[model samples]
Target: MQRQTTIKKDVSYRGIGLHSGREVSMRLLPAPADTGIVFVRTDAGGRQIHARAANVTSTLRATTVEENGVKVFTIEHLMSALHAHRIDNVCVELNAEEPPVADGSSLAYFDLIESAGIEELRSERHEIVIDRVCRIDDEATGRFVMALPYDGFRVSFISLNPHKLIGTQYEDFHIDAQTYRREIAPARTIAYEKEIDQLREMGLGLGGSLENVIVYNDEGWINPLHFADELVRHKILDVIGDLRLAGIIRGHVIAAASGHALNTALAKQIAASLG
Candidate 1:
């Protein structure tokens, strides 16, 4: 049977939070069996928030978690990395409002987990294997996520960016620790000049630079992809992170024209139903 796992030792890192633009320090500490993944804001007197879809208060541009007016933003990338590494229970301690952006992908997250190592727990894992078809949609953008019954989890993604370099990138992958780390973890987030300008107007993406996220103009693929299929692989990486809001998922997910908003919406719907 698939068992729960946790970091064998504590791992730490420091970087700028994608949205907050403030330097933050975070540590991933091993937790007892069945503890589940929990985020504690040490900067706020140790406020603990369970990593579950129900706690997601906002999906505006990025996933945001809230409890009693306390908020954490830009969490999907880190959470996705943890999940991809097959970590089941962890104590994520942060000294700021958000986790570090770290190259805008899960690559660094993967590296940290590799350094810390993984240990199995006594308890068996609970996976949300879909027995019914479910879907969520954004009418204006025609973006949606659909889940179906399957033996193992998988994701198919299609991204549409107006930038000529990133107009339409498609990727499909069966979700697994090996495949995720090898294929998806290196896909950096892509952005357009127009959107960056808009984010600047709203005082967001203040820490974003071409170094962390791939900035594209009308030209195609400005950033060099570590993998030949980095664009689509990143989509799979994103799907993994977004699904974690459900706490854990065990079935296949197929999506098209989906982004953080739609992905989290589907996860919340699934998380609610499973309860």
Candidate 2:
């Protein structure tokens, strides 16, 4: 049987928050078996918020979790890294309201977790395996996500934009630790040139730069593309992270034109169905 896992030692990362534009430091510490992933707001009297769909308060541009009026924002990337590494229990301590948006991808977080090392626990791991198909759709946005029975975890994603730079794209992957680290973790988040102004006006993406996020112009990417289908691959990364809110999911997920809102909605439904 597979066993639960946590970091071997404490690891830390420092960077700027994507939306807040404030420098923040976060530390990941090992936790006991069955602890799950818990975020502790050190600046807020050590408030503990479990990384679960029920605690999610916002999914506007990024995922945010709240407990007792205390909030933590932009956590999907880090959470995705933990999930990719098969870390079942971890204590994430943050002094600010959000973790740094390092490189705008899970790659940095993955490196930090790797440096800290992973230790398997004595307890066996458990996952919420979908026995039947579960699906969510947003008619207005033409977004949809579905979970189907599978022997293991996998994700299939499709992205479409009216912009010529990023037209229709599709990707599918059977997610495993090695595949996640190599293919999914390095795919950076993307934003369009036209939307940059509006995002800045809304006080979001303040720390975003061409170095971190893939900027697509009318012609093509401002930076060299990591993969031919990097946009869809990044969508898969976000889906992996969002699904972590329901704990480790063992199934195949298919998504079309889905974003944070649809991801969290489907996560809530999946979590509820398991209960």
Candidate 3:
């Protein structure tokens, strides 16, 4: 049987939160088997929020989970890292309302887990295997997310944008720890030049910069690209992180222009189908 696993020791990091723009410190600690991924807000008197689709309250620019009036922001990247590593149980303690946006990608968190090492638990791990095709769509935007039966976790995404620099980009990943670290983890968040001011007016993306966030304009890209099709790869990365809330999914996720809303909705759908 596949055993649940978590970090072997404590590890910590601090950085700027993408939306809140405040410094947030997080500590990853080993948890008892079957604990799943749990987040506790140290600043909010130890209010705990279980990382699950049902707890998600917002999917604006980032994924937000709330419990007992406490909200945690921008969790997808770290969650994706945990999923890639097959970490089934861990206690994440945060000093603020959000986890830091280190490098605006999962690479930093992945490295942190690597440094801490993984420990297998005696408890058996449970997987939500897709037996049939399931789909969710954003009718207005024509974006959709779906899952199909596969032997391993895989994600195929097609990023559709109207901009001249980024029109249509597509990529699929057979997700594994190594593939994630090398391909998806390093792909940073994307921001259009025109959206910065609007995002600021809404009090979002305050910590975003050319360094952590890749900016593009009508003229051209303001920053360098890691891969020619990095945008589509990052979309796949987000899907991995968001769907992870349901547990280790043993299937293939196929998507097009799907963001947080469709991602979490599919997660909830898959969770509900589990017996």
Q: Which digits, one per residue and each the tens of the lDDT, describe model 2 over residues 1-275?
A: 99999999999989889888888989999999999999998999999999999998899899999987788989999988887887899999999998998888899999899999999999989888899888999998788999999998889998987777678999889988889989999999898888999999998988899878889877777998888888888889998998899889899999998988889888999999883
**What is the Cα-based TM-score of model 1?**
0.94
The sequence of per-residue lDDT tens digits that candidate 3 reaches over residues 61-160 is: 8999999889897999999999999999999999998899988889999999999999988988997899998799888888999999999988989999
- Compared with the true structure, what per-residue lDDT tens digits does model 1 show for residues 1-275? 88888999999999998877899999999999878888899999999888887788877778888886577888888888887777889999999989999998888998998899999988998767788987998888788888988887778888776555556878777878888887888888766766887897887898898778876666555677676556666767777887887866767788887877788888888888873
Compared with the true structure, all predictions reach lDDT values of: 0.82, 0.90, 0.92
Candidate 2 weakest ten by summed lDDT: 158-167
For residue 243, what is the lDDT in candidate 3?
A: 95
- Which portions of model 1 miss their true places by more than 4 Å? 227-229
Better of 1 and 3 by TM-score: 3
Can you give the TM-score per candidate against the true fold? 0.94, 0.97, 0.98
Q: 1 or 3, which is superior by lDDT?
A: 3
